[model samples]
Target: MVRASTPSTWLQGLDIPSQLFGTTGGSDYELYEEDDEFVLTIDMPGFETDEIALAWDDGMLNVAADHTDENRGRKKTYHRRFRFPKTVDDEGIAAEYTNGVLEVRLPTADSTAQGTEIPLEG
Candidate 1:
């Protein structure tokens, strides 16, 4: 089982602009293994394709999004990171975002755990 970090509650409990815009609430994500691949699903309520960015570095997957309301001067940003396992094929990973959800597919590397049977000498 894999779990992503959640937004700090202490940050949301405070009443400051910097806190509100900084470490406040964030989008939710779910991860699971499917066949020979791992799937990640994130919920993004009000974000455009252009506002989101994805990156992979140091065996970690990073996602960041920023949004601002022009008329209200309100801004919100969401960021999340996921660490890939050694069995994952990071090079072939793919992602797509639509209908307020982001989906990432990470294919697993070729099976390397082989088994061999040995006959007992009588």
Candidate 2:
């Protein structure tokens, strides 16, 4: 399942049952580890690349965007924070925004996964 970038608190009061799912109901981003790197992609429409800001700090990634439309007198804002499981190469981190999509890659320091896996008891 694709998780939403930010939790939709405004939809929580809706009558629809799916609204209860909030951020978990739909997907606007994809995250995975490949080739010794962690890749995170977020689909953000109606915002320019310049309006978006990405920052990495202390094993956490922060994504924020703000857009203002003076003609329509409206403002849009987005903010999300993510914490990775393993140690990442901070100097090797990179990001790109194109066609309203943001993609970030963080190189892993080693091949081992951070935590011990729990055995599934069915």
Candidate 3:
């Protein structure tokens, strides 16, 4: 599913029942900037790396996961989106999942422009 830049905007119209079956549900996540990389940590227990999907488009980061609890005969879906600030380098983003936590790293914008000197002739 496509998501807007703002996460709350898409969560307002959530369908609870459908979400329990196979639709997107609200998921908890944390975003922070540290050193040269922006970090995003999301809680997604009971899901394998292959069952999750991620996408970055138009400055919006989208994450979705689906899994079935066969022992309980229940299915669940978790989804979230974040609007990255212009300071992020979208092209260098990377993700890794370990011990049920998904961590994404987004490098800071290149500094080449910051050091550029423009000459003015008036």
Candidate 4:
């Protein structure tokens, strides 16, 4: 099985693709800290805004979307959870979906996330 030599918690709990399933590298979502907040963006095409659901509990944020086509007899579902290092201002969280992209802004008290990135050795 192939495995990615990446940090377990890239950008503080950002989940990358599993190499066990023949995938590797960074996560599907883009996460960065700026303006005292962590901005996360994920490309989730083919799912309507009404079908997507988001919830926050403590430091964990859950994103889920499901779409079913009766005529085609098919269902598509996507779900992911993100955990942040700093205490998130849950009330300040905002999300927007447009053109098959989902963007979420998680406000944090810190300007940078905690932890040091380990340098990879050749």
lDDT of 4 by residue, 1-122 (tens): 11234544553355545555443333467788887888988889999999999999978999999999899999999888878765788889999999999999998854465568889999
| Residue 99 alpha-carbon offset, candidate 1, angstroms | 0.7
Model 3 has an lDDT value of 0.78
Candidate 2 C-alpha lDDT tens digits along 9-114: 6865665686466556236788888888899988888898889998888999999999998999999998888888548998899999888889999998865665
In candidate 4, which residue ranges exceed 4 Å CA deviation? 1-27, 110-122
Candidate 3, position 5, lDDT:
40
Best by lDDT: 2
Clashing pairs in 3: none
Ranking by lDDT: 2, 1, 4, 3
Model 3 Cα lDDT, one tens digit per residue, 1-122? 22224334455588444445433333356677888988888878899999999999877889999999899999989877788766678889999999989999989886556556789999
Deviation from native of the Cα of residue 62 in model 3, angstroms: 0.2
Spell out the clash pairs found in candidate 1: none
TM-score of each: 0.69, 0.72, 0.66, 0.69
Comparison by TM-score, 2 against 3, better one: 2
Query: For model 4, which pairs clash?
Result: none
Model 2 root-mean-square deviation: 6.2
lDDT of each: 0.81, 0.82, 0.78, 0.80
* Superposed model 3: Cα runs more than 4 Å off: 1-27, 111-122
